[model samples]
Target: MKYLETYRLTNLPAKAYYIPDFISDAEEHFLLQKITNAPLSKWTVLSNRRLQAWPTQLLKGSVLPTTDALPTWLDDPLVQRMVSLDIWRQSPHDRANHCLINEYEPGQGIMPHEDGDVYHPVVATVSLQDGIVLDIYRKTEDGKREIVYRIYQEPKSLLITTEDMYTDYLHGIQDIDVDKSLYRDTVANWDFLSDDTKQRIELSGGDLKRKRARVSLTFRDVKKVRNLAAFLQMK
Candidate 1:
């Protein structure tokens, strides 16, 4: 984790990094286009959001299909850039083997939850289109959840969660169009954010109003994979 110390989010957990403008504006548009123009069959529609799994969705047993590697649209410079950070040095694959693209509409969000052990603990997330606030909590001995920190993710940015940030805490976004109670004190990565980004939030009177849709590209390495041909032959 020392390799990534420069981009670390020290205000929150032991290991998490937020890189603003991680991708150029052009790359952001490229990914957003790929998501929006993808075939309807590719999307897995859920109650609050929709998702697309590259290669294929994981089986019920948390097994990934070995039919094909992730498409170029899902890999390329993003994965290469992450590899340089040395976050996945201990993963089974040593690189991301799966990707889940999630599209969230205004006022839609998932509940606080852990990523679980089916995959490696490291998560490299890239945000596109709009911004949002992620709230993190730690479970106490009394079984109560305490809000420990908050992260404001902006478009074209990268958020990497590993170590304590990935294993010991739960993270989620609020299901509201407006995110209030903002400032450098509230957001864990405030000091790392660009000055213009901070001003935009401050000028809005500490209220971040969601005005557009957002899509997240979450990359992780699954621990188990079975070749599709071999799996079908067993049946």
Candidate 2:
């Protein structure tokens, strides 16, 4: 993946990349099917969205606490493809050990926040079903926050964030049905978007309405893992 540099969001911060059409249509459909068929108990419904944590959720919101590996469906192609980029080469586990499948319905969104230090600084996100705009924020000396950049993530795309881009800024999506003011000048990854996506946004007068729920698969390597060897021995 030496050519990965070509996908870097140069107009934005120090390190972030966007790859449009990272997965084929068949692959997206397959993943969505798997997620759809998962047990109802696996889903943790939240105020604005629903999510499933693979291999188990973090213990006390800080430790991975379980040694169980991600399921084959979550690992094989998605994580494997990320491995090719070497983004986890320096991570504690040298690979992603946790995956969060988050589903956001129309008019739903998350507030701006950082991933924190529980996991490695790198984060790999795969978008499915629909597209959305992520707003990046930086704090001013006056102790207030302001949006500094924006990213339009297309369906079947992969977005990687690390280094300064991971720690130096906050990222979030706005709670709106239609993402407005989208164009080359306002979006960090505009040049990397597919032609069809660009044309659609343009035809809508710089607005892209959200008609379907969007799912994001976020992968990261937790820095802390509890030993389950003794527990396994008794099983």
Candidate 3:
């Protein structure tokens, strides 16, 4: 399949690929169950959302400690598909070593921030449950920011961000109950969404309301890792 022909967002930055229904409903449900069933300690509570850093978070921006491979629930199908896309082929690892599972309840969203230097400049995020709009911003000379674009992420869809789009801009979700002012004119990937999604948005009079909880699994290749022994010695 020609990925570019499937979901093209020309108005935005250098690269952003949106693939609707990238996973089957059963796959989505299985992944969601795995996430929700994780030990309570797996979740780190934030002001607006909760997240689980798989294989453990980075240490000093250079190393990953946990040697256990990602659970099959997190690896199969999804990760396989990602590999097939060759999205991480150019990264140092050639495959994502970490996954950040973020669960956002209604009215909860993350602050606008860049992923920074911890991981390679590519992020492949898979959305589950409800859909939401990702707000992209451009940095200004004075350290202020400006809203540059919006990308709608639907359930079971995959969004890949790379190149200048990843390093040169900041991305986040707004803390709002409803995503308003949605239309082809405002949504950067409006033409790429599934027909059902587009129809629903149109039926809602161009404003998409958020009703269910949403979970996003962001996959990235962490460039740093130390063996368990070395990591333990450094601590």
Instruction: Give per-model CA RMSD.
Output: 2.0, 2.6, 1.6
lDDT of 3 at 27: 93
lDDT of 1 by residue, 74-165 (tens): 77878888898887899999999899998888898888899999989999999999998889989999988888899989999899999888
* Model 3 / residue 187 / CA error / Å: 0.5
lDDT of 3 at 42: 95
Ranked by lDDT, the better of candidates 2 and 3 is: 2
Better of 2 and 3 by TM-score: 2
TM-score of 1: 0.94
Off by over 4 Å in 3: 1-6, 232-235
- Each candidate structure's TM-score, on Cα atoms with residue i matched to residue i, is 0.94, 0.95, 0.94
lDDT of 1 at 195: 87
Q: Model 2 Cα displacement at 145 (Å)?
A: 1.0
Across residues 53-144, which tens digit of lDDT does each residue of candidate 3 receive? 88776777667765755667778888888888888889988888889999999899999999988889999999999999999999999989
Q: Candidate 1, 65: how far from true, in Å?
A: 1.3
